[model samples]
Target: MTRASLVVVNYNTASDLRACLASAREKLGDAEVVVVDNGSTDGSVEMVREEFPWAPVFFFGKKGKV
Candidate 1:
């Protein structure tokens, strides 16, 4: 079950990102999903990590990077 890589960037959009992730999971379950959280204060990173633990999440700081 090998599929292409999927990269999604999120910025304080928790609910919408979840929906997109759900759709991607359904359509491309075999693919690897990577979610890059750009300095979120609404707990987007936590939500993604807890709910979609299978996916790898990269979190950037307030400057959107280290």
Candidate 2:
């Protein structure tokens, strides 16, 4: 079977990310989701972890610097 991957970069925008993830889940369905969090201080990472637990998360310290 073929596999798909989705990479989402999050930067303190939890609402946007949530909406995006919802759409992605609806569309992709079986694809793997990868979330790269750029040191979000607004608890975006935590929300992603709780809401989208099936998706893989990668943490990168600080945004614009990486």
Who wins the TM-score comparison?
1
How much RMSD separates candidate 1 from the native structure? 1.5
lDDT value, residue 41 of candidate 1: 87
Clashing pairs in 2: none
Global fold similarity of model 2 (TM-score): 0.87
| Candidate 2 residue lDDT tens string, 29-49 | 988889999889888889888
Report, for all candidates in order, the number of backbone clashes.
0, 0
Over the full model, what C-alpha lDDT does candidate 2 score relative to the true structure? 0.88
Provide the lDDT at 13 for model 2: 92
Q: After superposition, how far is residue 34 of candidate 1 from its true place, in Å?
A: 0.2
How do the predictions measure up, each by TM-score?
0.89, 0.87
